[model samples]
Target: MIEYGFRLPSSHDNRPLKFEEFERHLDKTILVSATPGKYDYEKTDKKNIVEQVIRPTGLVDPIVEIQETKGQIDDLIKRLNVVIKNGHRGLITTLTKNSAEKLTEFLVEANFKVKYLHSDIDTLERIDILRDLRLGVIDVIVGINLLREGLDLPEVAFIGILDADKQGFLRSTTALIQTIGRAARNVEGYVVMYADKITDAMAAALSETERRRNIQIAHNLKHGITPQSIVKAVKDIAQHRSTKLKGGKKSDATKVPKEERLRLLAEMEAQMDLASQNFEFEKAAELRDEIERLQAEWGL
Candidate 1:
């Protein structure tokens, strides 16, 4: 079994899973991460440790640059405008949810298509926001913490990390590396950390990124490979899963009256709950997406 995001289960999150539990059940497992923790190293043998430093696509890690925090917002706006003009997206990571929201507002006032994502936003809505970014509905996303891991946005070319010198979990070496990795999918990947002084975390993150980048560059040169931006098909929820309600029955949402649509929505929501309790997550997700689609299409 391939255990991607192996750090989450071992992390000290709100409801962190016991990594030992997976060890107990799975006879053979492969743990994957860019920055594995101490426990992962201790659990595996030296011979078993596999390092995948070079990407198969020959895409090098982003070029990391540090800029002064003075007039950082204005600088970021100028940089984002250039990124958008090149038909690419940008990501900004702030320290807090309020900072993210305020920056998003300022960008909107500057006539940029931007949105903010934080823990306060509903989970489903966050998924929709990310889909919008992928589908080119939005050009920039300002977020905190949530943008660090498990995000695959190949269209993104620039990432601006605000307050990189801040000493905290959010600005730690691991966190900085993960955020910087967001821009790694594109050929023109680049990252800028706005900080007046370089903290230890920032220094380490920059060094490590440069190391990985050198390795990738050497590999590409040896093979005479040209890096290409990752091209992934953006799949909508409705396209991936059928819009038919539970029990495999299809309903034409357009024909339904407003009052009837509301009732149907409620029914589907209840069915979704039941599916959840029954541990039928795939069905529950299908129903949830269908509900969202109907709400958007019908303007419910």
Candidate 2:
């Protein structure tokens, strides 16, 4: 049997993973990310690396502007107002959850339609919050590390990165690049770094962004094309809620015959393993949770 999987190079604590042990089990590997992390650079073959620079939406990369961090929050608010007036949206990433919450409050007081997202927010609310942001119910969204990746916001015209000079995992070159990519789907995309001094991370991010921007500009000019923002419709959360309810209506594990219950448990465990091997951690975690729930029902 063959197995394949993927993981972020860093752990939840922001330390590098011990890949020596992991590499022992694999014959081949492929590393993928919008901004490859340090481990990718150190371990992967540079010649084998694949670069995907052209976005299907034909959106040009954002213009990055460095601003003083002395009055970062106020500075972001002033700029976001212009984005809102233009019927576009803004995203702001701070360094901490407290900073995110504080900024959200400040934006609310300023009468801007805004919301803050973080690990503390419940899963259901996170879905609703993102849906609302896309639907224009909220003009601005604030987040910390969560805003760095897997955020698909096509209406985002501006990204305000606070504490951009702070050196660490949050300000790493990879993190900065991922955050900047959030604005890449919009025609009017732009990134504003609230920093007094440019760090190595910022410089690398700027250089890469410029490279991609130039390529995109050349492509647009050659094709006689105009950049356009993507418009993705918001999906209703109620459909997911209904699906959850239907899936929860399974037969009680304790009520099933012993042999059948064991068979079901075995099947689920196999699926969980398959999910893990396929690098679908979220699906694997869900299956693990379901297994535990079934075990509890069976009084195991």
Candidate 3:
């Protein structure tokens, strides 16, 4: 099985699965990450570690800057304004959920298409929020910790890290690097760390970022290449999954009225039954999850 996310199970609080049992079923594994943790490194030899430092787009890593924490939110707004004028997007990471919501509110009042993401948001809503950001429906997304890792927004040119000097897991070296990675896909990617003082974690993260940036720059120079931003196609979720569901069409379930939602859920149930009868277990499982997600979103 291919493990998709960059984060290992140990990094998070919740235990979704027993790692022992997970490994027992594994004959072999290909763990991928920009920064490998101790656990994954221990599982493989040094020779097995493959470095893919060169992005196909030749996009370099972001230039990280430090700013004072005082009035940092306003500074972020100014930076985001510049990014917005350039037809790009920004990601903001605050120290708490309250701050995330407050920043999002302030930005919205400033006439920016903005939203906040946190643990409080439901899964389907989170998906919709991300999709909105990708489609340029929203120009900014504010989050506490979730924006740090596994968030791939190629259009994001600016990343603002509030309270970067705060000594905690959220301000750790690993967290800083991961957050910075969100901007790596864009040609104009840049990170602004709002902190009065540079902590050890900040120092380490900046140094590593600089090291990778130098390597990438040298490769580009040697190859006579110019950097370009990544252009990723945003997939229509329903349409993308429909191919596996046997000619199923797109669902506007998220946008429909309550009555229409119920009708769509009923239709999905019929499709689920057909998938099960066809011995398409995986497709049936996906339909089941989609049905449940719709139910949860609509409070059915």
CA RMSD, predictions in order: 10.2, 8.7, 11.2
Model 2: lDDT of residue 6: 54
Least accurate 10 contiguous residues by lDDT in model 1: 242-251
In angstroms, the error of model 2 at 4 is 35
Number of the predicted model whose lDDT against the real structure is largest: 1
Q: What would the per-residue lDDT of candidate 3 be over residues 1-300, giving only the tens digit for each residue?
A: 126677776666656668887788898789987678889889989998888877767788899999987887678878988998998989888998787888888888999999888776644466667778878899998888766455677889999999899989899999899888889989998999999999999999999999889989999999988998877787676664555455444455567888888788899998877654433434666777677666755678
| Better model by lDDT: candidate 1 vs candidate 2 | 1
lDDT of the candidates, in the order given: 0.84, 0.79, 0.81
Per-residue C-alpha lDDT of model 2 across residues 1-300, encoded as one tens digit per residue: 113335454433565557786688887888887667788889788898888897766688889999997877778878889999988899888888888898899899999999997776654466667678778899998888756455677888999998999998889887888888888888888999999999999999999989998998888888887888887776555654445445765655556898888898899899977654443444655666667667766766
Residue pairs clashing, model 3: none
Candidate 1: segments with Cα more than 4 A from true spot: 1-31, 44-48, 241-300
Clashes of 3: 0
Candidate 2: which stretches are off by over 4 Å?
1-30, 243-300
The alpha-carbon root-mean-square deviation between model 1 and the true structure, to one decimal in Å, is 10.2
For model 1, which pairs clash? none
lDDT (Cα, tens digit) per residue for candidate 1, span 42-139: 87888999889899898999999999999999999999999999999999999987888899999999999998876666445666777798888999
Q: Model 3 segments beyond 4 Å from truth? A: 1-32, 41-50, 238-300
Q: How many times do residue backbones clash in model 1?
A: 0
